[model samples]
Target: MTRVVGKRAARRAELFDQLVGLFLDEGFAHLTLDDVAARLRCSKSTLYTLAESKDDLVRAATVHFFRRAADEVEEALARVDSGAGDRVTAYLEAVGDQLAPASARFMEDLARMPGARGVYEQNTAIAAERVRTLIAEGVGAGEFRSVSAEFVADVVASTMVRIQQRDVARATGFDDAQAYRELAALVTRGIAR
Candidate 1:
């Protein structure tokens, strides 16, 4: 019985990862369960069994993305061997790297769909708080200079979002890596002591 439950849980996690990858590759607004099922070569009913609804899928996908992002940030922070300023730069660069893709389309879709606005806003608030907590920890450890952790976190999050938006706009016009590099440099300068 335990083996069966574990197998089921593993399968569910696999489906969730597949769905998240699809959402990131193709904008969520343009993606459908049928598409996910087709990609998985499974039935839509199977996806519904895994997720309660489309909204549930969106929430799960959002959580998955943020969780992965937080892990990467943690790893980047761990790698920083320099002062608070350098650590701040590492963190900002890590964040920009995570958000450089799909950031613009995600925001545009959220704005266009009134129904999703609340969920998006709630998710953003959660992300901001997570960043704030991380910044507070960095400050406590002297890995970040003295500053209002909450305010700096908010600015960092907002800056990342805006940079991603601009990246999407210039997707065809400019290289994403170049844009992210420039933005990271600016953010690092602003946050550095």
Candidate 2:
């Protein structure tokens, strides 16, 4: 994973953002240095200016993408929504937004890559903890049912993982984003007092 610190980190982030969509369209395993360069409209030498190998490039890009995603989700949580429920829903939607454009193949590739999977797992866990905090706040405000926030938080996190599964999406005819919307609705209603 790229430390993403130091001079010209903004330039590095900009480059990573440009490549994220390409990687999501054609997973790391399928994309070669030539393919990346072609898609990026840059030369292999320019890519080497960022990373030494293809694998390193992918790892850094994945990490950088997820880091930006987490920041967005946190920003969503901090917004002054209509209510705590809305805030939570916005946060969940933000989570979905992170991978809104990722293809199923991209998801499968993520599972196959340990480093990428770690970034995904860590983000989900953070989302889960944030959900727990919101749930407790809602309950305290008498806006949500007085339920076990921790348990429900765990369920929300697990549901997030399940929503990303290809089989679940195929069986339900809901893409990851749709699955998240439905799940958010279910959770909001399920916990509503």
CA lDDT, every prediction?
Answer: 0.64, 0.81
Deviation of model 1 at 53, angstroms: 2.0
Model 2 / residue 95 / CA error / Å: 1.4
Instruction: Give the alpha carbon lDDT tens digit for every residue of 5-92 in model 2.
Output: 5546776667788888788887778889998988888899878988898877887788887888888878876775688789778878
lDDT of 1 by residue, 14-93 (tens): 87777766666665787677777788778989888866877767777666766777688779879988766566567656
Models 1 onward score TM values of 0.70, 0.87
Question: Cα lDDT for residue 127, model 1?
Answer: 51
For candidate 1, the lDDT comes to 0.64
Question: Which candidate achieves the best TM-score against the true structure?
Answer: 2
Report the lDDT of model 1 for residue 143. Answer: 63
| Model 1 ranges with Cα > 4 A deviation | 100-107, 110-151, 161-183, 191-193
Give residue 58's error in model 1 in angstroms: 2.2
**Native-to-model Cα distance after best TM-score fit, residue 124 in candidate 2, in Å:** 0.9
Model 1 error, position 59 (Å): 2.1
